[model samples]
Target: MESADETNTKLNGKSPSPVRSTRPKRSVRLTVKPKCFRCDKCKCEFSDQTNLDYHVSIHATDKPFHCETCQLLFSKRASLKAHVRTHSAAASAAKKKVFKCDNCGSKFTTSSHLKRHTRTHTGEKPFVCDVCGSKFTQNSHLKSHARKHTTDKLFACKNCPSKFSRGSDLKAHVRSHVVEKTLKCDSCDAKFSKKSHLVRHKRKHSGERPFHCDQCAAAFPENYMLKRHMRRHSGEKLFHCDICGSKFLEKLYLKRHMYTHSTEKPFHCDTCGSNFSQKIYLKSHMLVHNGEKRYQCEMCDSKFLRRQHLTIHIRKHTGERPHQCTICLSKFLTSSNLKTHLRTHTGEKPYHCDTCGSNFSENSTLKDHMRTHTGEKPFWCSICGSSFIKNSNLKSHMRKHTGEKPFHCNICASDFSQSSSLKKHMQTHLNKYQPL
Candidate 1:
């Protein structure tokens, strides 16, 4: 039987042990059991001794492999070798000369990177996840995607109470809490947390549409946008609301839609003391108090607090009714307007009043009907001490205070505040001009 010192000498190819063995030099033909190496930190068991040695080094602070350019230490020599390429790639990028892709004319510092880019044209996904069978062109993407299957959250945020599986995602999330935006666009004053976000923003300025849909002629600036657009053709709604049984194109939209079902309003307005289910709704409502209209129409002098409102206003000038009803053949400027029109045809009154037990097709109409029961007069006249349930009625009442008559008679040029009053005044002229 060989000694432990003799085994170490055989494994490492080093000199013989300095200390003498206490055991007798006897040929012990004992049955040798297979050794199972277990990691103390992660509690992972390995059959191979070489694999266990590599796994144990990851938990240690002292790294044997170090990059010469960045001086960044790595536990494994392969990781250090990979880190050296980033330095050489950056240096080659400064020279503006590298291996170019013949298909897309995209340049890469390394031939390996150029080969990976060529896979985009070839529609090849070499790396695949074993757990979920998800494929990717790069091995790094497959490793990142594999984290979704695991329950481990190795990276934790210091600023917020959040954890991430990947260190890169944690770093990106940390920037959201901090005001620091390191990446800035060259053409615009817009800044972003990551270089990828800055690159995506720059595409808006450059009018570059890199990702194109194979099914249709639609193209997008980003791959995620193209993936989202592909869902329209595929008729795939990945997210669904359990309460209303309504499906949505995106997960974020479904999360926002869930706020409607929630009775609790966490976000409160400081000015009006109004509560909102979501923080974004409260932020938008705050713009009304501040009178901030950031979005403006290019075709008209109309301005809106929200971009969606500005987009709807632009359709009035352009006469572009993109939303069409299949049942009535009616066109609408916005999807909300089309939805309301569909409710009229289908008799789908979604908005219901709890107090009166009355249902309304439109939410605005239900809100107005709610004022009747609650006696909540939100609109108020500044000139008089009068309050109104509707804003349109308040505007009509304001015309009486200002003495500005909008409704005028064509014959006598007589003006009136209310349209009904003008119609009654026109009857007097009609009686005078009657052939008796």
Candidate 2:
């Protein structure tokens, strides 16, 4: 008879993924000190099979049990019993390190998560929805995929009429209805709702072009941007002009160009009675009417309606301002005015501000800002051309220009552009004596 210590052996075979090594393998041993039921060293206590059947099933190297969802193979029947919990939704409720991926930092308690993430690198799609020809790398993707085929919107917003396919989608959409834009950029003051959209915004600040087109040297930050840019080179005009019959790649370009063809101005200013065909033109016009840009410059304390416009305004504070004066060795404040001043030296822009008889750095800003003294808005709104000491002040008065801050300073009643300003203001108590 072999001693228990001498007979103690380690199985020498490849284990699947080595995750099983953390848990010692347990199997029914044939050797017995107690009397055997039918024969010696033969029967399993749990099963009735005593001879070849019991010996082949439990003591075998072959993995007879396997999972249908995730491609995980198991050797023992009892080990396969615990594997089924991974596919269950309830299993996701309590998360432990059930599985981890080596390629990416993402970790999940279920083996399925690691499997799904591996698909991102391999581009594998095991799950496919039958209703639509949509394929997904994971079963959970198939669930979200099926929702697109059906009119059954399970996720409905309590506050709004909006409906969505998934519960998480509805939860994100609800955040937009609030009076706040809490999503601040790490690089800048810009805020956005969706993280994907914020990522797109980040690329704008960083000037990152991740999406590349093989057809051309052109690249964009997003897939849709690349798709749109590719159309320009390919001349793939999907959006056709009704009047001229000329086609454009994008709907927005066609819409903006439609203004030349159509006399109908859809976008109208409530204050000035000015009308516009394009929605963006309407938004710009509405901004003109409202005279407001909520985004203020952190450097020199200037405000802009659009975040990009404010970004351009920010270049003013830094000496890196590209807009330079063409006259004798002079550099000026902002890009807009630099072009106008360049005209005086370069004599580039022949257009002059008539009231002051001053040649402008920019024909537009000078033209707009000049209305201050004349109190004359020749481009008066059909609604009302309100008076301001400056046209910029008139723009500031535009009722639509509301900042994120609803409250103002109690002492001066001065309005701040953002809520962060108020928070910083309140903190001034601790550092009141501190020098700048």
Candidate 3:
């Protein structure tokens, strides 16, 4: 304490200073790294080089990140990872709980799905769009409807100039470019691009109509057909033709009606070298060449090439006149007959002959009238090779070859091949009974 340490402590009442390091101190070198990695497209900046490269990949047309579970592709790996999780979650949830709707007995994996399905029966539309004020049963459907208000088309066709707001619509449009139809019908030569279309086509051969309408006794092979049938009851013609301003119940009917505007026949028949405006018309024409009467009437020996013709022919035996006129209350066997009958009341002669300036209420009548200008006799007798303008004329001429006297007089009980001949014979009986 009385030494140099005590003298230094007594002077300031403190201890001596600590010794410092002799080696050079290292500087921290605080460098603020700027976002040097900038994207050429969109001009997005990122601190990390890997993140910038990922952001640039989004602008590329090709999607490198592939989901093995669903064959879905994404631009970013993170998005692919998230989509993979959804597949896993769906698989797991399917195995776990199965939520069912009490009203419709529809089974779904999640309670949310069951709730959304319950809205179909209850007619509950909880989600409403702010833009168009349209209501939807689910939030996802509302989101889809909201896209109609915006002009932003995110999805575009690579092969065409068509752009779609929805990815599903773009996917459906891409199917048009597919040249080959993978789904083939085992019963017929009909081929389809989609499995659903093939399944529906097979129903035509099997006569399996699973879908039924609640409002009527009508049944259809597909659910869409049942939905289309409901439009008849509603009297809703939503689909419109731009050329003729004609409205149709369905888009398919509108599409078929569009062919009337143009003389171009795109569909060709390979067998007869004939052309048709629609593919369905070509298909129906091919049945004539093949002589394939697949549909047969059980009530009579008469057979028809088409199922609809057989259905109408069966109604003749049943006397079931379902279609009725609202104005005159006249019942018709078929809808076409009713439509033609209505034209008689309205005096709507839509079909006109360009050559003769003659008008006809029915298109078939116009076609027959056009033959007068062209001097075309399509109907021919097989026995005598005699041609006629109308099918009725050919049918009447066929009785000469077959010796068929269908018309009989009640007075003389004499049979005549033609009705005109029977009328002339009835006059002969009347002349004999006259007082001389």
Give candidate 2's root-mean-square deviation (CA, Å): 25.7
Per-residue CA lDDT of model 2 for 121-181, tens digit only, reads: 5655678789766556567657876877887675566667787776678767967777456
Number of the top candidate by TM-score?
Answer: 3
Model 3: per-residue Cα lDDT over 1-436, one tens digit each: 3999779888999987878989999988987778988776445678889888877766565566776543456877888898889867865774665686676454567777667656655666788889867666678877887888888876767778888887788778978886568778998989986455676687789998876665468888866687688667544454655444456888888889877644468998887576788999998898898877878888778988988899989989999999999999999999889988998998988776677777778777876776788798878888889999899999999998899999999987999999999999999989988999
lDDT of 2 at 426: 60
How far is each candidate from the true structure, as Cα RMSD in Å? 17.0, 25.7, 17.0
- Alpha-carbon local distance difference test for all models: 0.76, 0.60, 0.77
lDDT of 1 by residue, 206-292 (tens): 988866665468988876798799666544454656555556889999999887654467999888787798999997788899977
Rank the models by lDDT, top first.
3, 1, 2
The TM-score measured for candidate 2 stands at: 0.26
Which portions of model 1 show Cα errors greater than 4 Å?
Answer: 1-213, 216-229, 242-245, 261-264, 291-300, 404-436
Task: List candidate 2 segments past 4 Å from native.
Answer: 1-158, 162-176, 179-183, 192-194, 242-245, 266-436
Which 10 successive residues of model 3 have the least lDDT summed? 236-245
